[model samples]
Target: MKYILFIIITLTAIFSFSQDKEKEALLAAKKANNYVYEGNNLINEDDFVSAEKEYRKAISEQGTTVAGIYNLGNSYIKKGSYEEALYRLDQAAKIATSKVEKHKAYHNIGNVLMENKKCKEAVEAYKNALRNDPSDEETRYNLGLAKICAEQQKDKEDDKKDDKDKDKKDDKKDQEKKEGDDKKDQDQKDKGDQDKKEGDDKKDDKGKPKDEKNDKGKGDEKEKQQPPQPRPGQMSPQQVKSLLEAMNNQEQKVQEKVNAEKQKGYKIKTEKDW
Candidate 1:
């Protein structure tokens, strides 16, 4: 029974070793390492496209190692691929087993967010990184920068709102001014029309002559403005007395002439009344 037990134990150990070998073969650690090395060298040379390709290859082979994914995220950042960088950095943070790795991942995530002009999210990311590694001066500095950026963005939005409101007020004033000008023109036109109507009512038409009675009424108005004239059968008392005195003077002159003729003759003739 002891011999049989020893043989069974030896077979179990051989089966375990085979399974380990197969798993190692499937993982291809050496291949993954080569890709990662090539990717790092490409990054150093600033060949971002090539570097990204190598990093992706490494990730496919190694199945998301912290170093591989983090480097890939950095490559994306250098390429200005913010969304991709954010995704990779977030994945790196989730898979990280140590505080150092977590700090680096969150720091890179903050950088990506900052690049995208998402200052608020960047601030939170930097804060998380600081929580993981409090001694990181870079993260603290970045947090301060993010806060300043956030304030500047808010001020910009407020300025835009003020400008919009000012534009609205200007438009309203222009509308009111236009309405006022239109009303003024309309009033002038109405006044002109009213004057025209009055003129029409005062004048004669081609087919209808002016009324004689109206002419007489106008003459009466003129008479009221002047002195009264004498009528054919009527005269002032001063004028009548002047005319009677003139007639009496003329009769006296005639009588004197007649007596002078009679005196020169020295004879008189009388005729019988018939």
Candidate 2:
């Protein structure tokens, strides 16, 4: 009988402990819900700072409170803190226990991505939202807009690439043309210098052309073979002839005197002959 009483006492202690734990859990859940309700009222009043505090309190009271996380994310969106909003919304979506909760979180995540100009990611996010709640017309509409934005962004990038390519091609052509012009100018300058050097080689000391000087020498030889022409400072051919005749007469007189001296020397020879 004492053993049975001991067993009953042990069972009662265990049940009491279990019941106490259940009551504590219920109390915490009630506190968490109260904080979430207070945060909602603050959000409606446009008091985001106070609402954020209340939401944080709800999350601290009950770590599994989806409403606390989701509302906190929405508050971040209102504050334009998109990165924070995305983080909280993503957490809420992962921990969501229902499709309705998941749809709300994904839809807001799409909104944040769209605000940040992430159209491609936003389109995927909206698509996920629709997967959870196919009846949501708003998510479908946002998905369409995101698709259009993504295409426009892609086309803009393509146009920029094309413009860059065209600019590069034009630059290359300009550089080639500049190089060709430089080469042509150098060639013309070199040719001009070569022609000048050849011209200098064909000249004489007197600055006269060598070919003209040679032709002048040939003309001088031809003049020597032709009859002489009289000039103002020179004797004529007729005067030269007169001067030669005078010289001949003087020589003949001298020869006659020499013969007279020979006849005088011959008198002695005639007497010897008699």
Candidate 3:
């Protein structure tokens, strides 16, 4: 049983060693130098699309080297594919063999981040680039610019928020003002209707139609003709004058009698038997 266990362990070790050897051979077989040279030539001629293909081929052949990934990332940047460029450049930074290569990776990463409007992240990337290669004045300048851009971006966002809040408040006030104006208009209309109704009731009590007031006024001159008097023998003016004189004398006698009774402290009340 012990011999079997030993054999199993030895076989496992042999298998692991063989796998490592195979992996090393595969890595060694990848020759990306020629493809990278060809890609560079294409890029110099401004043939970025073809250069991207060449760089991709080189990356596939070289199994992720700094040169292949950085070139591919540069090509992607020319194509305006900032997201892909950022990914490739980040990979280049992780696997870079030297400080110069790492600096280039970080510098390109900052460029991609800036294009994507990630100013704060870009500032950090440029700072990293400067750290990797302190002699790179361009990276230092970009870091300064990124800092400025981050501040400007924050200011712009704050301005937008302020403007948005102001607009919201203005809209609310306008709505409230509109509601108040509508209510005022409605109240005025109701009062006008009530006044019109009252005027109509007054007209009805006076027994006049709305259109008859001017019509009745137009007939006033025609109504001014005197009524016809009776003919002679029906009544005489002298007889009417005599009857009036007799009635006056009777009224004077009755009034004198009433005044004499009132002087004797009497409450003289006149009663009507209708």
Candidate 4:
């Protein structure tokens, strides 16, 4: 009965092991210490897909060992998964047991954040790396350089955005001004036409012809705008003749109006007007 129980338990364990057979095999390789180097070799060869798979296998076998996690994060970084790199680097940092491991995780996190343009956050990460191991002059110098580049890029982008906004506002204002000018010009033209029409109405009520009224108005406007005459005696012969002809025409018009009133059965009260 004891032998049968042992055999049964052995079979169950085999079955469970078989279910995670691939993971167990990868773990065996990781325990040999060469899988990390092999994964890094694949990364150096630019075989990112294979490198990613190898790093993932390594991490699964090694759990959250700082070196494994950091290398996994680097593999993801090579694959352009910056967000995933950040998360893996974070895990590496938490599990780090030594200054070297801790600083490495911090630097990697900073690098990924810098790539993602979370500049302020990256600066903090780099600072944390420096605090862990201030002897890494290369990292400190890189941090300073990255900060300068990030700030310059941000300033350039902001300036471009501001210029674009200003240009848009100026364009809108110009368009509005053009529209206003058009409306104002249209209104002025309409008003001038309306005044001309009103003048025509007054002329029609006085029974004056358009040509006559226009000529008379032009002459009166000219006279008003001209310098004053020396005296009535200074009038030219042509001007005096024109004035006498106009008076004669007015006298004939008065007589014709009197005759028209008589024909309509209305007697004139005085002959002086006729």
Candidate 5:
């Protein structure tokens, strides 16, 4: 039984060796030198189409390297494939094990975005590059340019909003003014109507019966039309009191004279009956 197990082990080892040998042979045939040769041939012949495809295949098959990815991206750019180049380069950017590698990746991304007319994205890329490597004056300048563009856009928007608000405020003020004017007009109209009513009342007063108005109208007519009667002041209280006393004395005198006349006229007669 041990001999059988040994035989199985020997077979397994041989199989593994054969597989490794075949892989080595395949790698040797499609060597790194061959990819370089292919890339050089395409460059010489100006076969960017075929060259780009070959470069991309080479990059995929090889281990991740900035040179390979960057070369591939360049190939895509030559073929007018901006999006493809951007995608590959974006991958290269993340493979930064060192700070310098990270800065290079971010810096290149800024250039790519700039080419695509995406200044805002370029600004962000350049800012990231500067963060990784702040000594880069080019990145700082590019970031400043992007900021200017962004600020101009913001200023334009602010101006538009300000104009809109001004228009709204003016409209509101105009409406208020109109309302005030209308109120004033209505007040004037009401005053005019009151004056008109007063004028009509004056006309009515003019149309009243003259006789009834005469008492208030003419003092001379009242005096002439009425009999000459004693006024309150003409017959004063003291004068009235003296006249009444004189009238009382006259009445007593009249009674005494009447009684004397009656006594003088008396006639004596003998009569049994009364």
Candidate 6:
């Protein structure tokens, strides 16, 4: 009987504790909802800074409050804090228990992505929004716009790439042509140098041709081995012969005169003897 009484007392204590926890949860949820309501009022007045504070207070009061997180994300969007807004909105979407809440979060995410020029990602976000609520005409319109923007961006990127490729090809051609011209110039220079070297090899140190100089030396040696030749401005052999003949004629005339004188003396002596 004592054991049964103790069991009853334990059951009573457990039930009281459970009820107390439920009451506390209810009070916290009520406080969080009040803060969310205040935040909404501040947002309506365009006091986003105050609204952000209230939303943060609501989240602090009840961490699992979807309205508080979603409102805070909207406040960030109003404040132009897109990265923060995306973070909070993504969190809200992940924890939201209703399709309507998910659609709102996804639709806002698409808007933020569009503002950032992420058209492709925005298209996907809008698509997800429509998946949750296919009746939303706004999401459908945004999706169409995102598709067009994404295509335009792709075309712009393709044009830029084509221009870059063309530039690369032109540069390559120019470089190749320059290299070919340089090689041709070098070859001509090398040929000119070779021709000059060959020309120099055929010449003597005195700038005369080697073969002509050698022939002149051989002629001098041959002249030295032969008879002596008359120098310039000397008498010729014919002039010497004419002078000898004249001398012989004069000697004959002198002899004839001496003989005639001797004959005259002999005749005179014979006459005396008679």
> What tens digits encode model 4's per-residue C-alpha lDDT throughout 74-97?
888988898888888899898888
Compute the lDDT of residue 239 as modeled in candidate 6.
70
Residues 1-274, candidate 2: write the lDDT tens digits. 9999999999999999999999988898899999999999999999999999999999998888999999999999999999999999999999999999999999999999999999989999999999999999999999999999999988999999999999999999999999999999999999999999999888888876788767999999999999988999888999989999999999888677778878888532324444
Give per-residue lDDT, candidate 5, residue 35: 69
Residue-level lDDT of model 1, residues 115-216, one tens digit each, is 889998899999999989999999999999999998899899999999999999999999999999999999999999999887777668764545879889
lDDT of every model, 2 decimals: 0.89, 0.94, 0.87, 0.83, 0.77, 0.92
TM-score of 6: 0.71
Name the top TM-score candidate.
Answer: 6
Q: Give per-residue lDDT, candidate 5, residue 181.
A: 100
Candidate 1 — which pairs collide?
Answer: none
Q: How large an RMSD does model 1 have?
A: 14.1
Q: Predictions ranked by lDDT, top down?
A: 2, 6, 1, 3, 4, 5
Best by the lDDT measure:
2
Query: Alpha-carbon error at 268 in model 3, in Å?
Result: 37
Query: What TM-score, over all chains together, does every model reach?
Result: 0.62, 0.64, 0.61, 0.54, 0.44, 0.71
lDDT of 2: 0.94
Question: Per-residue alpha-carbon lDDT of model 3 for 104-125, expressed as tens digits?
Answer: 9999999889988899999999
Model 4 spans > 4 angstroms off: 1-37, 44-47, 79-84, 94-98, 113-121, 203-274
Clashing residue pair totals per candidate (backbone < 3 A): 0, 0, 0, 0, 0, 0
Lowest summed lDDT across 10 adjacent residues in model 2 is found at: 265-274
Q: Which stretches of candidate 2 lie over 4 Å from their true place?
A: 1-26, 192-274
Name the regions of candidate 1 deviating beyond 4 angstroms.
Answer: 1-30, 94-98, 207-274
**Span of 10 residues, lowest total lDDT, candidate 4:** 26-35
